[model samples]
Target: MNSVQKLGFSENAKLLIIHADDAGLSHSENMATIQSLEEGFVNSYSIMVPCPWFYEMAVYAKNNPKFDYGIHLTLTCEWENYKFGPVSPVSEVPSLVDENGYFYKKREQLRKSATPEDVKKELQAQVEKAIKFGLKPTHLDSHMYSVGSDAKFLKVYKEIGEKFDLPVLINKQLMQMVGLDPDINIKEGEFVIDNTYIGEFKYFEDGKLGDFYKGIIENLTSGINLILIHPAFDDSEMKGVTINHPNFGSQWRQIDFDFFTSEINKAKLKENNIELVTWGDLNKIRKGK
Candidate 1:
């Protein structure tokens, strides 16, 4: 059965998951993500376990156990100045790190060097650390799409998700985007969204974010849809953290925050009859399976 039916929704129901990514990269990111989850249309977020602000996110998750948060299983630290390495010992997962002893700054670098054993070790360590800090993570997803970039990495990612009984973010569309076979068999009972949208900020050149999102919401199909957004305050902190990167930088994130939080966006959801579901809700389906 498809996700909508499996979740007990009508066949034509438009299910949407507005998930904020990079929740623990910096103070600005943490603050914006918390606000977006608590006060805005964003229903879910994932914590970057290897980032500097991970402890802050962990404490928040511990205190607010009801929020739908997950581990953004991190392998590559893509910032210029800001960087992090494996939660496991460097000696143990040596192939997962660069010469500087930090995670490689790009997915291409990681894909060339990281071994499956190292990936599994580091991923397990990240999940274990989150659980140790009192976070019952709702799901798992990759940072920089690293884990899903290769078949071997994906194998370890799937294994870890199965081990934890948490949903790993995977979709046929995304698989195809990375030159993987879209028809790759997923284990029975594993939750997979039918479609996932990661906003392309290049389309937001001339105050077009509202239109871009509205178009996406309107075009959403029957099955579950996950929209990945990075919501952060456009402050000095965020600016500094995302110094050279304009793709998902401070201003870009603020636009996401603004659009997702706007009353018009809420109205659009109601107008389109889109049912916002959380990763926690998806977990219920996993449990039943």
Candidate 2:
């Protein structure tokens, strides 16, 4: 059965998850994501535990228990200047870090240096820190797709998800991209989404981001579909943090924020009959509630 049916929705229901990524990466990101959650189209967000502003995001989650949030399990620090390291002791998880003491800035670097043991240790520390800070994450997902990029790391991610009884984000496209066998069967009762959409859309006309999103909403299939967005304000702080990275940089993130917050986009979802769901909803299904 499909994820919508498992969640008690009709098989034909077009379920969508408008999820914000990198909630704790910066003040701009936190502010934009929180605003989007409160007054925009973003129904869910995930925190980067190892980022510098994690405590701010954690406190917000603690105060707003009704908002759906999860952990964006971080492994690589992709920014050029701004970087973060493992929550585990640097001495213990040395392989997870680079010579400069921050995490490697690329997935290729992480794949070369990190072992499964180090990955598990760092991931466990991230989860423990979230629990310690009074933030109960609804699910687990990878940062820069690192955890899902290798079968060994994917095993560790699944183990952690099962241990915490939280649903981990998994899909066939990611499995195939990482050279894993996409035909492996998901366990019964486990929640697995049918598709996940990330990165920028290619069909650009008049340079309007909302047009791209409208196309996506209109074409959404009948199943659980996850759309990952990184929303932030285009401010000096965001600009400084995003430096030379123009793809998902401050301007790009602001475009995402504006597109998701637009009234037209909200209407489009309704017009397309897309049922917005949250990670918390999926977690309930995983818990058999």
Candidate 3:
């Protein structure tokens, strides 16, 4: 059966997952995630286990068990000044890190050096670490979709989900965005979210990101859809982390926080007859399976 039918909706139901990515990147990120989830349209989010702010977020997740959260299996640290590394010891996942013992800044750099074994080890370690901290993660997804950089790493991503028995964020478009051949990499009958949306750099540059998102709600299609956003304040901490990176920089994230949390955005979904779902809801389906 299709996702809509599985969710007990009509076949033509427009199910949407407004997911906030990067919850544990910083204090600003954690605070924004909390507010967005508690008071905004964001229903799902994932945590970056290797980031310095992970424990703070984890504490909140532990206190509030009803919220939907997943592990953002991170491999590359994209920030300029602030950075993080593997959860496993550097000695164990040496190939996954640079000389500074932190994750590489780009996926291409990680793909060039990361061995499949090390990738599996680090990703699995991230999952285990989350569980160890008493935060029950509902699903798994990749940070920057880094697992799709190589086919072997993609396989590792799937295997880790199976090992942990959690659903993964699998989509052909995400794989193709990372230069993986989706037809060859994704198997037949596998669950894939083909209609995933994220704000483009052009939208941020043109100051039309809110319009871009509004259009998405207006034109949403049948089956499952996803909109990945990063909610953070444009503060000194975020500015320091995103220095020289204006694409998903501090101000851009602030726009994301404001737009997703607006009552008008929530009303637009209801008026358009769109149904919002969560990774936690999806986890119940996986567990039942």
What C-alpha lDDT, on a 0 to 100 scale, does residue 132 get in candidate 3? 94
lDDT per residue as tens, model 3, 174-238: 87788998889989866677589988899999999999999999999998899999999999999
The lDDT ranking, best first, is 3, 1, 2
Model 3: lDDT equals 0.91
RMSD to native for every prediction?
Answer: 1.6, 2.0, 1.1
Residue-level lDDT for 137 in candidate 2: 88
Rank by TM-score (best first): 3, 1, 2
Clashes of each: 0, 0, 0
Off by over 4 Å in 1: 185-190
The best candidate in terms of lDDT: 3
Clashing residue pairs for model 1: none
Q: Could you give candidate 1's per-residue lDDT for residues 1-289 as a string of tens digits?
A: 6667778889899999999999899999999999888878999999999889999988998898878899999998877877788888899999989887999987778888989999999999999999988889989998877887678999899999989988899887677666678676455555678888876756666667667788889888887998889999999998888898887888889989998888878788888889999988888877875
Task: List where candidate 3 sits over 4 angstroms from the true fold.
Answer: 287-289
TM-score of each: 0.95, 0.94, 0.98
lDDT of each: 0.86, 0.85, 0.91
Compute the lDDT for candidate 1. Answer: 0.86
